[model samples]
Target: MRNLCMKVNYDGTEYDGFQTQPNGNTIQDYLESAICSLTGERLKITGSGRTDAGVHAYGQVFNFHTESPIPIERWCLALNAWLPRDIIVTDAREVPLTFHARRMAKRKTYRYSINANRFPDIFHRRTQAHHPTKLDVQAMEQGLAHLIGTFDYTSFASRRSQKTNHVRTIYEAYMTVDHSFSRPGSDDQGIIHTYITGSGFLQHMVRIIMGTLLEVGEGKKSADDIPFILEAKNRSKAGPTAVGHALTLWSVEYEENIKKH
Candidate 1:
């Protein structure tokens, strides 16, 4: 069997998540079923990581082994033809037999979006988290600055995380405001985007970090309190977990060697 690597993009609104679960309406389940239908092989696909429910993906990667005689380039066309409209196989190619999507990943980037309007927009409701209050962006930036280094992020992790090692490095963490108007020159709304890139993330790490920064923005928590929160190593010391709908798996990066054949 030859290993095939694929880049997947999906709108996670209707599905449970990326991984296959007994509930059965997941991205992986659809992809695997499509592959099985096309190639007549019952193979399991390994994704780079699990994306929470309602979390979209722009460039998620996965791999599976199949003995199908179909060429690599045809895999994309073949799979997309069989898969659901929301889940698309953007690219596919052959990979080394030893390649593993999750273990070989170098970094992952996630973005959480917030709508700063008092009244939520009906069109963008599914993707953007509606926070009606005006937030102090500068204070939020101050709190984010403290997260850009290696630390034991137990405080930022969720209770759902089962990992014993909480140490993870944050390469980048920042928030930006998108000045988009409903009409020309109408400053009715602005989109707040929170981007985080790291070696890896614990369950709900990015969302919790965004929530903590929101607390700082609201004067509920001070930027200087970040290090203390980190020192606490307790989940309760952190802010509430942000809404999952606003979070998206923006991208995943693999090492150079892994990308090379």
Candidate 2:
């Protein structure tokens, strides 16, 4: 059997999530079924990580073992021919047998986008979260800048997560306004993109951080309170959990040698 790795892109609006569930309406469910139907061999695919429902991915990675005779370069075309339009396999290559997508990843990048205009943009309703209010962006940036180091992120983690250790190292965290995405005449006025790259993330960690920053921007939470909140290690000390739709797994990065293609 050949161990194959693939980069996938998907719109997570209609599906349950990345992982398979009992109902079998997820990105993985479709990928596995399509591969089976195409190769006549049932196999399992392992993803770099799980993305919550309504979240999207621009550069998600996955690996699977297959005995099919298909060429590595053709996997993308074959899979796209069989899978739904919302999900597409962008690249594929063979990797060492020991490679495990999630375990071997060096870093992961997630971006949370907010539409803070006076009126919602109808075109981006599914991908961007609508927060139609004035925001103190400078205060939000102050809060986010404090999160760019190793610390116990328990305060920003969700109670629903089962991970015991909430400590993780954040490599980079910043915010920027995206002016490229726009309608025909109207410019992208209030599109805010908050980016966070880390070694790993706990469940709903990005969304929770976005929520905390939103509160800071709204003057509900002071920027100076961030350090105290991190030290508290209590989930209640954080702000509300933002909606999942605004979050996107932007990319997954691995060591140079690990990427065969």
Candidate 3:
């Protein structure tokens, strides 16, 4: 059996999530089914991370061991041919026998979008969350600058989660305005596009961070409060986590020696 890694993109609006559940639609089930049908082997596929329902992805990854001798190109071609419209296998390549997709990843990148305008755009409605009022851009920048570096992310996680260690290093995080997405009868005046890349993310981490930063941009929270929230180690200290629909796993960085084509 050969371990093959694949990069995938999915519009998570229709499916339940990445992990498989009884009677629920998931990415893993689809990939396994497609691969099984194509290769005649029912393989267990493991993803790099689990994304919540309604979350989207531009470059989510997974790996599975199969006995079939199909080339890497056929993995993408055959899977795309059989997979549903909401999901697509973008790329595939062979990897070392012991390389695990989730374990070997060096860093992960996530992008969040917020439409901070009154009018809603049809194309962006499914991807970007909406905010009623205009945000203070300067204050938003201050929060972003303050957020740069390694710190505990306990405040930006769900209280129901069990992970005790909240410390996570954030290499880079910043937000920008996206003026290109325009819909009929809607004005794209101040739509915000926020992208954050890091070693890894805690459960619901990006959304909570986005919510806290939004509060800071509205002048409700001070930028200096970020450090205090981190120190508090309380989930309730941060703002409410945003919805899953606006978050996307943009990409994942693999070890330098991993085969890439």
What is candidate 3's CA lDDT for residue 176? 82
Score candidate 1 by TM-score against the native. Answer: 0.94
Q: Residue 184 lDDT in model 3? A: 49
Residue-level lDDT of model 3, residues 64-176, one tens digit each, is 88888887777788888889988999889888889898888778889998887676777778998888576786787777777678888778878766777877888888878
Give candidate 3 regions above 4 Å deviation: 181-189, 259-261
For candidate 3, the per-residue lDDT at 118 reads 74
Total backbone clashes of candidate 2, pairs 3 or more residues apart or in separate chains:
0
lDDT of every model, 2 decimals: 0.88, 0.90, 0.83
lDDT of 2 by residue, 189-217 (tens): 57898989999999889998999999999
94 Cα displacement, candidate 2 (Å) = 0.6
Off by over 4 Å in 1: 182-189
lDDT of 1 by residue, 180-233 (tens): 634455444477888899999999999899999889988999999999999999
TM-score of decoy 3: 0.93
